[model samples]
Target: MGKKAAMQKSKQWNVKGAMRLTSVFHFLQSCGSGCLVPFLTLYFRHLGLTATMTGIIMASKHLLTLVWRPVSSILARQYDKRRTVIVGSLLSSALVVLILLLFPSAGTKAESGRCNASQPSADFTDGSDFTTLESMIIPSQSNVTVYSVNHTTVIMEQPDDLNSTYTPTLVNSSSNWSRRAIRYLRELKEQQEESLHTEFLGSLKAMDAQHQMFFLVLIVIGLWEFMAAPLEWTADDGLYEYLDFVDATDRHKGVTVWKPLGTAVGNGVVGILVTSLYCRTGTVAEFYSYTAFMILTVPTAALLPLYIRKRDRPTSGGFKALQLVHRNSQALLCAITVVLTGIASSAVSDFLLWHMQDHNATEIHMGISLALAHLSQAGFPLYAGHLAGFLKYHGWLLVLAVIALSIQCLYYSFLWDPWSIIPAQILAGFSTGALWWSVAAQCEDIATPGTEETLIRLFEGLPLELGSGLGSLMAGFVMQKFGIKILFQGISVILAVWSITLAALKWKIPRQRRINYSRLLTADTGEISESESDQEKDWLETAMEDDNQKNNWTIAKS
Candidate 1:
C-alpha cells in the first residue's frame, strides 16, 4: 500500500482501537463506585470527622445522584456520549484529588515541656539558713561535721516519693556576709528562671501529609468519574433501563432477576463471613480483607458486556439464535445479582460486627438469622422470576416482596425471633430484583428494532435506587422511633397499594409501538451516522475493486 493508503488504514485501526479502549477505561473507572461505597465512612473517621458529619457527607452524594439522574440523561442525549463519559469521569477524578490535597489530617501531635523540681521556694532560706538547719539537726554530740560549703550548693533533687524524709531550713544573720551566700542565691535562682521549649512542628507536618494523601485518593476517584458519567448515562443507562424494565415484566422476567438475587445473597453471605472473621481476629486487618473482597468484585460488573455480546453472536438458525440470546440473557441477570449481592453482603457483614452482642445466645441467634436471610434471598429471584415469567406480571412480584418484608418487620415489633425475619429478607431481594428486571427488559424491547440492535439496554436500577433511597431514609427514622417492625409494616402497605395499581395497568398499555426504525436506531448506537458511513464507504470500495478486476480478466481473455 502507498504511504497515504497505509496512513488511512492506520487511522481506521486507531478508531477501532479507541472504541475498544473506551470499554476497558469505563470498567476501570466504574470500580470507583465499589471502592468509595465501601469506605466513605471509614475515610471520614480517619479524618477525625464525627459520625453525624460523615452521614451528612454521604447523604450529600446520594442526593446529588438522585437529582442528577434525569438531568444527566437529558445532557447525554444532547451531546456526544463519549465526550460526556470522558469529561464526567475526569471531572469527578479531579474533584476527588483536590479534596485529598485540602483535607486535614487528625494525627498531628502537640508540643510539651518538662518541669523542673529543684527551684527554691519561700520555705527555704539563703546559704546561712541552710547551715543553721544542718547544725540544729546535728547537735555537736554526733560525729557529723557541718562543712561551710563554698560557692553555690546545687542539689539535684529527685522527685519525692512517699517514703522519702523531709526537712526544713532556718536562716540567721551574720556580722559579715559570706561569699557562699551570694553565689548560692544567684546560681540557684538563675537555674530556676531558665526555661526549655519543646517544638512539635514535625508532628504537624506529618499530619498534613497524611491528610493530603487521603484527600488525593478521593479527588482522583471523583475526577475520573467525569469521564464515566457521559458514557454511562448516554449508553449504559438506556440499556440498563431496558433490562431492568423488561425484568420487571413477564417478557424478560425468566433470568433477569438472577443478578439481583445473587447480589443480595452475595452481599449478605460475604458480610456475615467477614464480620465473623473480624470478630475472631479483633483487628482492622479483617476489615481490609473485607475491602479487598469488595474491590475484587469489580470484574463481575465488567462481565455484563460479555454476556450481552454473547447474545449477539451469529447462529445457525433464527429460532436457535433467539433461544441462545434468551439463554445468555441470564448471564446479564447473574452479573446484576453478583453486583448487588457483593455490595449488600459487605454492608450486612459490617453491620453485624458493629452491633454484635456479647451474650453467647445473642451471637448465635443473630448469625443464624443472617444466614437464613441470605440463603432465602439466594433463591428468591429464581422463584420471583419464574412467577413473573409465567404470570407476565413482574411488577406485582416486587409488590409482593415489599409486602412480605413489611409484614415480617411489623411482626418483629410485636414479637421476636431472628429466624422469622429470614423470609422477609429473601422476599425483599426477589421482589426488588424482579421489579427492576421487568422495567429494564421493557426498555430494551420497546426501542425500535434497528435501534435495539445498536443500542443501550434497560434496567430497574433507577426505580431500585429511588425505592432504596426512600426506604433507607425512612427506615432510619422508623427504627429509631417506632422500631424496625413498624417501619416494615408501613412499607408493606404502601407497596401493596402500588402493586395493585401496576397490575391494573398491565393490559392497558401498548405492548408494541410503531415508529421509524432508522431514527430510533441512530440513538441506540455510537455516533451511528459517521460510523455507518465509514463502514459503507469501505465496503463499497472493496466491491468496486473486485468488479474492476473481473472485467480486466475478461478483457485479457478476449
Candidate 2:
C-alpha cells in the first residue's frame, strides 16, 4: 500500500511537470522567432530588396493567418492537439532551413560599407562644400588608397604606413578645372544619396534576381506558417485548459505573468544572440544560424502533450465563429478597438529595425532596445489587472492604453538618435500589454453562448491579421513618400483621433455581467431534477428582468 501510494504521488508530480516544460518551450520558441523575424526586413535590405517589397512579404504572413486561423481551429478539434503541434513545428522548421540553404550570397562587408557611405551626411546640403562629400565618400582609414601621379588618378591598396610616398601630378594650375571637378563630384554624391534613399523607400528596380528569389522564399514560408497556425492555437488552448483544471489562479497567471515573463526572457536572450551573430557573421549567416537553432528546439514541443491531461475538445466551424461577432454591441466595439490598436502597434514593430538603422544604431544597441521593449512589455501586464481595479472600470484601461500609445508615437517622431528610442519603448510596451489584457477580458465578458474560446480567438486574430497586414502595407508607402519621422507623426494624429472616439463610445455603451459556465450550462441543460430546473428558471427570469430594466434605462436616456 505504501509503495502504491508513492508510485501514485510520483505519477502526479510527473503530470504536473508539463507546465514547467511548456513554459520552457514557450521561452525557446520566443527566443528563436524574436531573433530572426523582427530583423527580416533589414536582411531583405541587405539583399538589395526595397522596403515596400519587404513590407509586402511581411504582410503576407499575417494575411495568410487570417485565412488559415479557422481551418487551424477545425483541425485542432478533429485531431489530437499534440500531433497538430508536432506537424506544424516540423514543417515550419524545414521551411526555415530551406530558405537559408537557397540564399545566393550574404553581401560582402565592403559592399555594405559602400551603401552606408552613400547616405546623406548630417551636415550635407545643396550648398555644402565638395570637400565634406569627399571626406565622407572616401574615409581616411579605408583600405583603398587614392593618389594622383603623372596626370593620372591611381587608386591602389593602402600600404601599412599612412605616410607612404606617392608621385605628384599637376592639374591646370592656371585654370578653374578643380572647381569644375568639385562640382561634378558633388553632383555624383547627390545622385548616390538619391539612389540609396529610393532603395530605402522600396523602389521596384531594387528587385533583382536575388531579391526575387527571396520574395518567392517568403511566400512559401508564409504558406507553411499558415498551416502551422493551428498547432499554436492547439498548444495554447491545451495549456490554458490544463492551468484552469490544476490551479484556477494559474489560469490568470499564465497569460498575465508567465507567458509575458517567458517572452521577456526570450527576447533578452535572442537580443544578445542576434548582436553577437550580426557582429561576427553578418545578417544572412545569422539567419542561417537562427534557423538551425529553431529547427533543433521546436520539435521539443511535441513532447509536451505526452504529460498534460487532455480535455474534451471544443466544436469548431468557421461560420459558427463568425456569427459570434454579431452577437452583441460590446463585441463589435471590442473588435474595432483591437483592430485599431493592432495597426498602430504593428507599424512600430515591423519598422523598428529600419528606424534604428536609419539612426545609425549598432547591433548591440539594437539588441538592447528590443530587449528593453520586451521587458517593459512583460513587466506592465503584471499591474494591468490591479490598474483595472483601481480605476473601477476596465474601459478606463483602454483609454490609458491610447494615452500610452500616443506618447510613444510622439517620442518616436522626435527621436534624433537610436539609443533614445530604447527608453521610449517603455510607453510602447506598457500600452501594448495593457491594451491586449483589457481586450481579452472584454471579449470574454461579451462571448456568445457555446462560443467563449472561439469568440476570443476571433477577437484576437481578425484585428491582428488585418491590422498588421494593412499597417505594414501603408507604412511602406507612407515612409517612402513622407519619410520615417512624418510616418510616426501621422500615426500619432490618427491615434489621438481614435482615442477621442473610444472615450465617447465608452461613455455611451453599457456594461454587462460576464456569463459564466455555471450560468450558461444551468440555463441550457434540460431534464434536470425538478428543484434544480426551478432554480435555473428563476435565475434566467431574474437575468431577463435585469436586462430589460437596463435596456429601458438606456432607451430613456437616448
Candidate 3:
C-alpha cells in the first residue's frame, strides 16, 4: 500500500512537470512562429515577387499542412521521437531561413523604390494620395519626373488607372540624364508619370532575375512550410495526449493560453525591431529574430516528453466521419459554412499587414494590431457556452461567425489609418473564436458513434486548408489587378451574401444534440455504454477517447 501511494505521488509529480514543460514549449514555439509567419508577405514583397506568385507560395504552404501532419504523426508513433522531431524541425527551419536571407533579390525593390506620384502632373489638384507616407521623392528641378530612388534612373510606365497598379520604379537625377532637346511637348512628364514609349505593363525583360529568385524562394519556403505545420500539430497533439493520459485535461486551457500571450509579446517586439532596423539600415528584422527564437525554442522543445501517450479507446477514421455528414443535412450545411469561413479567413491573414502598410501603418502599428489579433479572442472562449446557449444552437452561432467575418471585411475595406486596425483585429479574433467553438460543438453534435475526430478533421483540416489556399490565390490576383481595397470590398460582399444564405438554412434546419458518450471516454472496450437501450445505437458509437473531444481545434490563432 505504501509503494502504491509512492507511485501515485510520482505520477502526480509527472503530471505537474509535464504541464509546466508543455506551457514553456508552447510559448517559445508560438513566439518564434509569430515573428516568422505574419511578415512572410512583407518578405516576399521585398524579394520583388509579384502578388500572384506570393499568393501561390502562401497557398502551397497551407495546403501542405494536410500532407505533412499525417506523415509526421506516423513517424512519431512508429519511431517514438516526438521530442526529436519537434526540436529538429525548429533547428532545421532556422537554418533554412538563415540561408534564405542570403539571397540578393530582396534588395531589388529597395534599389529603385517606386511610387505613383499624383502631383507629377500639373493638372492634378488632389494630393490626398500622399496624405501620410511618400514613396516618391519629387525632384525640385525637373519637369520630366522619371522614377528615382537614391538617384538611380528607372523606366516608368503611366497607367490609365494609377489606383489599379503600384509598380515601384525610381527616377534619375536631371544632371545624370543626357537628354536630347525636344522642341514640343516638353511638359508631358509634368502632366503624367507615364512614358509613351513604354507599355502600360512595363517590360518584363528586367524581371527575369527576380522571377528566378522568386521561383527558388517558392520552392524553399514551400518545403519549409511543409515541415512547419506538422511540427505544430505534433506539439499540440502531444501535449493534449499527455494531459489526457495523466488525467490532467483540466489543465489544458491554462497551458494553451500561453501561446497567444507569447504571440502577442513576440509579434510586438519583432515589429519594433524591424522598424528600428529598417529606419537605420533598411533591414528586415524577422530574419534575425525568427532564427534566434527558433534556436531559443530548441531547449524548451527538448524538455518536452519524447514519448507518445497511447489512448485507451479506438477512434473512427475520416471515412466514417464523411458518411455521417452525408447522412445528416445540418452537418452538411455546417461543413459548407466552414469552407467559406476558411476562404474569408485567408484574405485577412495573407494581406492585412500589407493593407495596413499601404495606408501608412508602420511596423510597430502593424505588429501591435497583429498582436491584438492573437489576444482578441482570448476572452471570447470564456463566453463560448453562454453564446451558444443564447443563440439556441451551434448552427446559429456559426452563422453569426460568418456574419462577424463579413462585418470585419467591410471594416477592413473602409480602414484608412493604422490605429483603426486594432478594433478590426479584435473583431476578427472574436469571430474566429466563435467560429471554432460553434464548429466544434456542432461537429460533435452531428458525429454519431465513431466519427468524432474525423468529423472535426473534416470541418477543420484539409477542407479549411483547401479553402484558405484557394482564397490566397484569388486574393493575390484580385489585389494585384484591382488593388487591396477592392479586394476586401468585394470579399465583404461575397461573405455578406454567404452569411445570409447560411442563416436561412440554419433557421430551417432543426438542431440535433447527440448524447455525450465521448465524456465517458474510458478503457472499456467491453461496452460503449455502461448502459444504453439499443446496441445498434452504440455499434456506430464507441469511446472516441479524450483526444477527439478537443474543441477549439480550428483557427485558434485567427
Candidate 4:
C-alpha cells in the first residue's frame, strides 16, 4: 500500500512538471515564428539584397525545414523529447548565429568609430579636383577616392562612411552578389542619411529593427534550450508527452501528428516571465520582450497533426468536410496580407522617395513599420487567448478577422486610388494575430481528444515554417516580377478561395472544457491522476487512428 501510494504521488508530480514544460515550449515557439516572419523582408532590404535574392534565401530556410522538421519529429519520438528539443534549439541557434555572422553588424568598435568619422578635407587647388572627388566619394560604399589636379587622387578608407564611394574604375562586374548588395545598401544608406526628415528613414529604421529583432530571437531560443532542456528531459512525461503516444508513428516515414498546446502555454508563460523581468529591471527589456513572445512557435509547427485531426472529426449535423481547407484558408489570408503590405511598401517608399529629401526619414519609416509589425504580432496571442476565453470560440474569430482583413486589402487594391496602401497595411497588420490564433486553436481542437496538447504543438510549427517560407519567396517574386498592383490582385484571389473553403468546412463545437489554471503551476502534480495502463491505452488508440489516416493520405506535401 505504501509503495502504491508513493507511485501515485509520483505520477501526479510528473503531470504538473509536464504541464509547466509545455508552456515554456509554447512561448519559445511563438517568439521563434513571430520575430522572423514580419521582418525577413526588412533584413534582406537592409542587406541591399534584391527582392529575388531575398526570396530565395528565405525559401532556403523552408527547404531546410522540409528536411529538418520531420527528421526532428521522428527523432523526438525515438529518443527523448527533451534531448530532441535541446538538440534542435542548439542546432537552430548555431545556424542562426552563423547566418548572422556571415552578415556584417555594427562592426568592431574601432571600425565603427572610423566609419562614423566625416570625410577628409579635399584639396581645392583645381575645379577638376572637386569633380573627381564627387565621382569617387559618392559611388564607393567603403573607400572614397578624391582626384585633384595632375591626376592626383586621395583615397580615404572608412567602413561606416556612406559618402565614401569605391573606385568606380575598380568595381568589377565579376564581384560576388554579397559585395554588390553591400555596396548598393551602403549607397541607399548614404542616400537616407543625407535626408533624415523623410518617411523613408522610418522605413529603414523599421527594417533595421526587424533584423535586430530576429537576431535576438535566435539567441533567445538558444538560451531557452540551454536553460530549460535538461530539466525537461529529466521531468516525468506521463501526463503530457507519454500521454500523447511517443511510440506509435513510423519514425522514418510520413508526418507525425500530435497536439502541443502545453508547449504553447509554456511559451506564453515565458513571455510573461520576460515581461515581469522587464518590469522589475529596465535593462535588457527588449530581450525580455522577445523571449516573452516565444509562445507563437508551437501552433505553426504542429499544423499537420491539427489539420488531420480536424479532418477526422464528426461534423456538426455534417456535410462533407472541405478538402484542402487548411491550405486554402491560410494561404488565402496570408497572401492577401502580404500583397496589401507589398503595395503599401511600394507606395510609401515611392512617396517618401518623391517627397522626402533626407535619407534618414526613409530609414526611420521602414524601421517603425518593422517594429510595429513585430510588437503587434508579439501581443497577438494574449489578445487571442483572451478572445478565445470570452467568446468560447477556438479560432473562429481569427478566421473571420482574416477574411475581414482580406476584404480591406481589396478595398485598398481597387477603390482607394491615391490614399497609398497605408489603409490596407493597417488592416494587414492583423494577419499574424488571425493566423497564429487559427494555428493554435486548430491544434487545440483537432488533435485527438485526450492527446490534444502534444500534437497541437508538434503540428503547429511545421506549417508556419513552411507557409512563411513559401509566402516570403512568393512575395519577393511577385514584387520583383510584377508591380505591387498585380501582387495585390493575386493575393486577393488566393484569399477569396481560402475564405470560401473555410465557410464550407465550418465545424463549430461549443466550448465546454473548463480552464485548468492549476495546469499553469510549475509543480509536478495536477488535480487528478490516472493509471499508467489508461495513459498507454489513450496513446495507443490515438496512434492507431493516426496511422490509418496516414495510409489513406494521397495529397502533396505543402
Better of 2 and 3 by lDDT: 3
Give the alpha carbon lDDT tens digit for every residue of 1-558 in model 2: 999999987765453576667666666656656656666667666665565766777678778878786666555655655555555664575465456435654333233443343544322323433221224343322344333333333344456776995443334523465445445555654565467555753443334445555566576668657655565566666666555455542442453344455445545555566556654555554455455555655656666633344555545433565655565556577678777777877778777677777777765666667777777777776677788899998877877788788778878888788788876876755687777777767756655544555666776788778988888888877877787788888888888898888888878876655544556576653322223344345566788899999999999999
Residue 195 shift from truth in candidate 4, angstroms: 44
Query: Which candidate should be chosen as best, given lDDT against the real structure?
Result: 3
- For candidate 4, the lDDT comes to 0.41
Superior candidate under TM-score, 3 versus 4 = 3
- What would the TM-scores of all predictions be? 0.41, 0.71, 0.73, 0.44
- Give the alpha carbon lDDT tens digit for every residue of 1-558 in model 4: 999999986764453344444444444544443333333344345444555555556555544554555454444444535344544453444333333324543211111222232324322432453334433234433244434444443333445656665542333323464355446546765886565556653533434433443444344434433433332222223223343443422221111111223323333433344334533431133233333333234333322121011123232211111221232343333334333333333332222211221222232233343334345544555566666677566555555655755565455445322234344445543664555556545544333333333433333334444555566567667767885556556665666666665555544322223223242242232222223333334444677889887877734332
What TM-score, to 2 decimals, does candidate 1 have?
A: 0.41
Clashes of each: 85, 0, 9, 88
Clash pairs of candidate 2? Answer: none
What lDDT tens digits, residue by residue, belong to model 3 across residues 1-558? 999999987865597788788888888788888887888887787777878888888888877875677668667756667777788788888878766676765433332222233225322323323121112333222332343334344434446664775563443435434132221124443433344236553333223456666777888887787556667767766676666666665576687578887888788988888777664544457877878888988887877754464543333366667766776677787778777777878877888877877777777888888888888766677777887788766577777788888888889988879898767788865578778777777776665544554577677676688788888989889989998889888888988898888888777765554544443353242233323243224423543433344434544644
- Over 262-332, each residue of candidate 1 has an lDDT whose tens digit, in order, gives 33333444445544554343223323433343344334333322112213323223233233223333323
After best superposition, candidate 3 residue 65: deviation in angstroms?
Answer: 1.8
**lDDT sort, best first:** 3, 2, 4, 1
The C-alpha RMSD of each candidate to the native structure, in angstroms, is 20.7, 10.3, 12.5, 17.2
What is the TM-score (0 to 1) of candidate 4? 0.44
Name the top TM-score candidate: 3
**Residue 203 CA displacement from its true place in model 1, Å:** 24
What are the runs in model 4 whose C-alpha is more than 4 Å off?
1-18, 21-40, 84-88, 91-99, 102-239, 242-401, 407-466, 483-490, 496-558
lDDT of all predictions: 0.39, 0.63, 0.69, 0.41
